[model samples]
Target: MNFFGTIFSYIRETYVDRLSYFPSNIKISLMIILFCAIAIVELYIYIIFRRVIKANQNKQTKYWKERIGNMLASVVVYDESENTAEIAVHFYDKLKKLPLKNSTVNQILTSEIITYHKNFTGKIPEVLALLYAKLKLDKRSKKKIDSKHWETKIEGIREANEMGISEMAEEIIKYTDDENGLLRMEAQAAYLKLSNKDPFHFLDRAQERILDWHQLVLFEIITKNKKLTIPSFSKWLRSPNDTVVMFCLKLIDHFMQFDAAEEVQRLLKHHNTRIVKKSIEIIGKLELEELEKHMFEIYFDHTDEIKLEILNSLGKISSGKYADFLSSRIHSNDSKIKRAALYAIKRDADHGEARLLEIYHHTSPENQALITHVLDNRIKQ
Candidate 1:
């Protein structure tokens, strides 16, 4: 106490005594500045301390992950009988011995298990699923699914799907039409994986537009899973949502559902020209020659874009029956329609080349050039 009193007396004599000579306002300002400087220094030190603590935590997490990963690897490679229960117990025991809080350890363990599950197949995935349940890690994911936060909900949906938690299907399906696009996409994917009965039942009730990327993901999931039953997409051709109807059209073309020809013919007269165009394309690809006459009837009533699609569809059909309709469009003011018409005429297997030559001399220079291009086998379309 005497040492501190001597230091305080010296500091007061050296600094505080000198400040008394200055004006009172200046003195108060100096004191305020001094306190602020001290505060800034203390805050800097606090930040450094926090960074040090975070670094140590990261190191500990990495060490625990490596240890957990090795244990999981051992469980995956056990070539003995399919005794997942015994294996799960042993795995859980090893994880419990780790020197970390249960929540932290479980987080790292869950992540590592999912990584392994994504890479493996057959019995290994089954064993990993068993381990995930035995440790009660699924509860964490389920809770996240119930989170008000959308990002957390997406993570939970992904985890449940990867872990094969089929019982979560009912809860997950509700998010399939979520206002959030990403969450809706993840939920849709999870439903496809988890549900066995009426896997595509969501389509019947989906109100939001299923974007192109979403469709791609769903298509990949469906095609890769051999056991997944392909639904009759023609059922949704009359859907109120135009995008849904378009997606169904793509699926119909892909699966070659010939029975959908009647339904597809109906869409050609639908109000949305985009859907009508898609319907025309599908009709051509499926070689629905019966619908060719209906396409001819609507060809004059639509825009050039739709007109171009009809011409292209006629080329695909190449039934030679639409030669008169193809030739009538050869004089169209739009160059695209003219070229499409010429190409369709050239595609006809019967008398198409001869028909092109017959109209060559009488047509305009631009039409002649297009015809020449179509006729020349060396020119790639």
Candidate 2:
């Protein structure tokens, strides 16, 4: 108190007393500058204090990670035996004896166990799952899932999915169509990972448009998990949602679900050009020779984009029946359509190159150059 009093008295005598002689404006300016300086000083102290606290937290987290990692390592490597339940119980007893009651400690423990679970398989994962339930980390995850914040819900869903908390599948499935796109994506992924019965049940009921990137993420998840039963995407082909139909087409193409070929053939006449174009492309890739006539029927009435896809598909089909149809389009006004036609003609193995040579001299110089480019072995379109 005496030190503070001395400092206050010195400031009063040194500046405040001198400021009284200055004009009112000058006094106000000086006061403003003094307050600004004090604020800057306080801000600097606050920043330094926060840094110290963060550094302390990082140090503590590192220590706990190492300790928990070592303990989990013992559980995984030293206890690989037939009696996994007994081993899990022993590990749970060991963990309870530690300082895991603290939330911070529990978080670290959860993270470390999840990391282990991801890196191992077989009985190891089963043991970790048991230990997770024993430690009540699932309850923590459940609380986060039920939180009002979307970010917290995502974190909870991710933790539960990663930890293989199968019981949380029902809770996570509720968010599959969340208004928040990211939360919906996470919940859908969790449902895929956790749900054993009808894992893709969300697709049949999804009302919202699944974004393109979200589709890619879901596709990757489905393809990578071999255990996941690949459903016949054809069932969704008749969906009212165009995006769902588009995604189902892609899946059918990838999985080579020839069973869906009939449904795909029916879509060639659909009003949506995007869907029609994809249907044509898939039919070509699948080499459904029967649909070639349908593609030819729809070729002239559609836009240049659809024409280009049809031409490309014909090239992939490489059936000699469309050689004349492909050759006729070589004179199309649209340069893209013309090139697509030339490529298709060259790709048609039955007398396609001969057809190109036959038209080379009769066509315009630009058409001749396109034909030459298509025929050139060095350029791989």
CA RMSD per model (angstroms): 3.5, 4.7
Q: Give the per-residue lDDT digits (tens) of candidate 2, residues 1-381.
A: 699999989778757578778889878887898899899999999999999999999998888888888999988896475688988988888888768777778888888888888989888888998899988889999999999999999989989999878888989888997878999899988899899888888788777787899999988998899989999999999888787898889889899999998899899989889899999999989998888888999887998889889999988888788888788886678888988888888887778789899989899998889888889989987
Model 2 accuracy (lDDT, Cα): 0.88
Best by TM-score: 1
lDDT of 1 by residue, 247-286 (tens): 8888888889999999999999999987898899998888
Off by over 4 Å in 2: 1-67, 79-82, 99-101, 121-123, 269-272, 361-366
How many Å off is the CA of 188 in candidate 2?
Answer: 1.4
Candidate 1: clashing residue pairs, number: 0
- Residue 298 accuracy (lDDT) in model 2: 89
Global lDDT for candidate 1?
0.86
Per-prediction TM-score: 0.86, 0.80
User: lDDT for each of the candidates?
Assistant: 0.86, 0.88
Q: Give the TM-score of candidate 2.
A: 0.80
| Segments of candidate 1 deviating more than 4 angstroms | 1-24, 27-31, 34-38, 41-45, 80-86, 96-101, 361-369
